[model samples]
Target: MKTAALKTVDRRDGKLAMAHFYVAFIALALGGLAGLLQTLVRSGKFELPAGIGYYQILTVHGVVLGLVLTTFFIMGFQLAAVSKTSGTLTNRQRLIGWIGFWLMTAGTLMAAAMILLNKASVLYTFYAPLQAHALFYIGLTLVIVGSWLDGAAIIMAYARWRKANPGKPSPLLTFMSLVNTILWIVATIGVASTVLIQLLPWSLGLVDRVDVLVSRTLFWYFGHPLVYFWLLPAYMAWYVVIPKVIGGKIFSDSLARMSFILFLLFSIPVGFHHQLTEPGIDPAWKFLQVILTFLVIIPSLMTAFSLFATFESYGRSKGATGLFGWVKVLPWEDARFTVPFIGMLSFIPAGAGGIINASHQLNQVVHNTIWITGHFHLTLATAVILTFFGITYWLVPHLTGRTLTKALNKLAIIQAVFWAVGMTFMSGAMHAAGLLGAPRRSSYSEYGGAAQAAEWIPYQVAQAIGGSILFLGIILMLYIFINLAFFAPKGEEEFPVGETSEKAEKTPMVFENWKLWLGITVLLILFAYTIPFIDMIENAPIGSKGYKLW
Candidate 1:
């Protein structure tokens, strides 16, 4: 068995990771406030002070939380994971990571400033026709480029480990981190292409118009994988860390690796599912991508099964008997476990909602409706965000050389409960209201007091109440984060990485074949996208002039 020479992240590397957390939490604070305001406005009970526009705050909410927060936290967590598993980064690697961090940070600031100044209110998707300032696109480009540099650090470390270990699969955490990094690098190419080749020049006035359909195509190409990019790290926690937290072994190393490989292969090529409702794409191509979307579900189910097996095995060994008795043995009192467990439970319905959205017939029902917003809230906001919170309960303290006091742990649990309750009220109402035909991304309006519009009022109020509760949850989370980072009692906290169950067979070496995986991922992308893209460009319209409605 292998053992770590150090129980905590290297002090220098911890500083780097801490830098990211600082920015991420700052974003949470700013973005959380924006979200609350949005809900209140949509409830028909609030208005912005001064000249603040609704879409401007909406842009802030989406960009800061959706893009900035997720990217920073994921990059930070992956860096720490790679360091913990593969050993501290070499000096060169560390330098590269720092450069990436600063670059991304700078980009975030530039983008944020533009949003706040109302120079860019294009929203997170930044879809063309509703164009923003050139700096907005440039800032986004820097963020993507900086992330590539950040990924380079992880890649270099993985290479070093392979060179040293020769013939052994990389450490599970390290390997997962590398896989996610590669997935990110590959997927971002679509967004990067649109930003560099299309959006930036159009925003700069070098082009009189932008191709709306083509821009959206590239965006969704990057957008769908972006979901998995956020998700894979959470899966990393579920697959590797959770078992250790609950005093159990991994169900199968091979299963875990295979699932990740499946994600890499299937996630990017399937972005067309998001574009299914849009015109200009052949129904046949959309159907093909829909098939690919369903294939992505296999890994999701595999992950679910592996987790159940881990929990059951742990419960069984602890003297539990009946089929569901394993549930009783989990560490419910441990905030680290309970918090993310809530997130895992949320995914049940969240996943179901996603399946509904991907269906061609069902897409028409919810597309551009508040129902889609509700689905997004459940998936990313509740499921992914809660898992991240659960991770913070240990991660912050571990990196900071502090211990999570029982009091703080209890508070963390409370925070998670608040989140669950709030989202139930909020997202549930959204889904219901959407079914009644409420539109998304609209400011407060009675729509000439139309009956259907009036029908949405009560649900919008429920959303406001839910948003208020969630903001409280955010405040609690921020308090806990502060205590963990600074005020918590000084001590060591374990960075848990689970051991694979002995009963599982050896992992195949082919899982480590980057050539096979990347080649397949590229081929799938080509197969799914090549023809449609060619058709889009060939039949493209005269494009659109930029508009700044906000």
Candidate 2:
């Protein structure tokens, strides 16, 4: 068996991965600024200057952070993890990665240009009848395609590893990366289909009308899975990397693989949960999808249990006593562990909020409300983004042939604390306002001094304060990133991957049986969506002509 070694990522592969990070961080800087401005605008304390529309900034905020930043960072981190664990990518694979990176970058620029020109202020969701410039659709299509190519590179690398090590399970990190790549590729097909078949044609005037329900349905199909796409990477770090960081063994490789498999199966078919309140979809199908949505919570809870077990095992080994004593034994000062630890802590509330969102009765109350917005912020913004930040504490330095210095490490922990504080204020206020019936995706207004609208203003102002603090957090993160990438001390920083515990059974080979899992995934999706989808098309109304309300 190939034992774990202190191996640096190949310099060539590092360059490819770093290219993705560069774009990711750039998106963060721009998107974070846009986010700050959005909070200020919605707080009714500031207005866009020089005719820049509120929706324009909103579009930038959502697209850059929600789509661009997440996609780029995830891709970059996965590539590096695969390379470190599986072996360096071949020259051709690296070439494919570069091509995908540039394509995504070009697409991002094209789409951004249109948005900045005020011709594509449709927001990140870009749901029609809110049409954007044709270039915007085309640009986004390129991004999706580019992501496919990037995924292809990861798949190829995995294939090569499996071929070389015929009887062995793939490295846990590599396997996890492969799973996420597959999930992304499968999930993106929904968004890609909607864009190519529906939105692009309508935006280009090739089609006079677009099906709003179908477009939205397709979007939510991709949309719900997209959150998992952001999340599974964090889970990878949580399951495989965190144990190694904190001087503990993986609780069970089998359990980890099982949870990831469950996520892949349950994550994709539950889009109707998002559309529960929308018309034209049958409640039965919605209920079924909601059940699938709830099933995904199983894997999440499993992960939590595994982590607790690992922590307790480590603490007990260290002679710590008492039921919760393990928590005290954890390496609290290690940024690599502590930063993502905060993210893990945040997910408790985040997951609860998700359960509330997915519930049918509760959905009616919070539907289209800022509560949904708060839930989203907590899930991706705190849980996922903070974990990504944690990864960067070591990843950027490791890739750059440097070490995370003590000062920088301390800064990273501080940055995470700032993020936690800021998100609490922001997301907390959003939930409060949303429960009070504040609408989402709208600029500030008093509704002619209506008392209900008046009630939301205080929360909005709290959001502004939180956003400002979050912006400072962003600035700190960027500073840490720049130092890690360009100026950190020249040395080796380990790319940690944990070993499985001896007490755990070997990971089942069945976990690697893609055909079986994928087959079930497809069947579940068809069972949930195929009938409703066909009902949509067969009973379709005359589609609405495109509108640019912004």
What global local distance difference test value does model 1 have?
0.91
Residue pairs clashing, model 2: none
- What is the overall TM-score of model 1 with all chains considered together? 0.98
Residue-level lDDT for 33 in candidate 1: 99
Residue range 40-71, candidate 1, lDDT tens digits: 99998888899999999999999999999999
- Model 2 weakest 10-residue run by lDDT: 541-550
Cα lDDT, all candidates: 0.91, 0.91
Lowest-lDDT window of 10 residues in candidate 1?
A: 541-550
Steric clash count of candidate 1: 0
Candidate 2: tens digits of C-alpha lDDT, residues 388-464: 99999988898999999899989999999899999999999999999999999886753655777788899999999
Which ranges in model 2 have alpha carbons more than 4 Å from their true place?
A: 1-6, 446-448, 543-550
Which residue ranges in model 1 land beyond 4 Å of their true spot? 1-3, 542-550
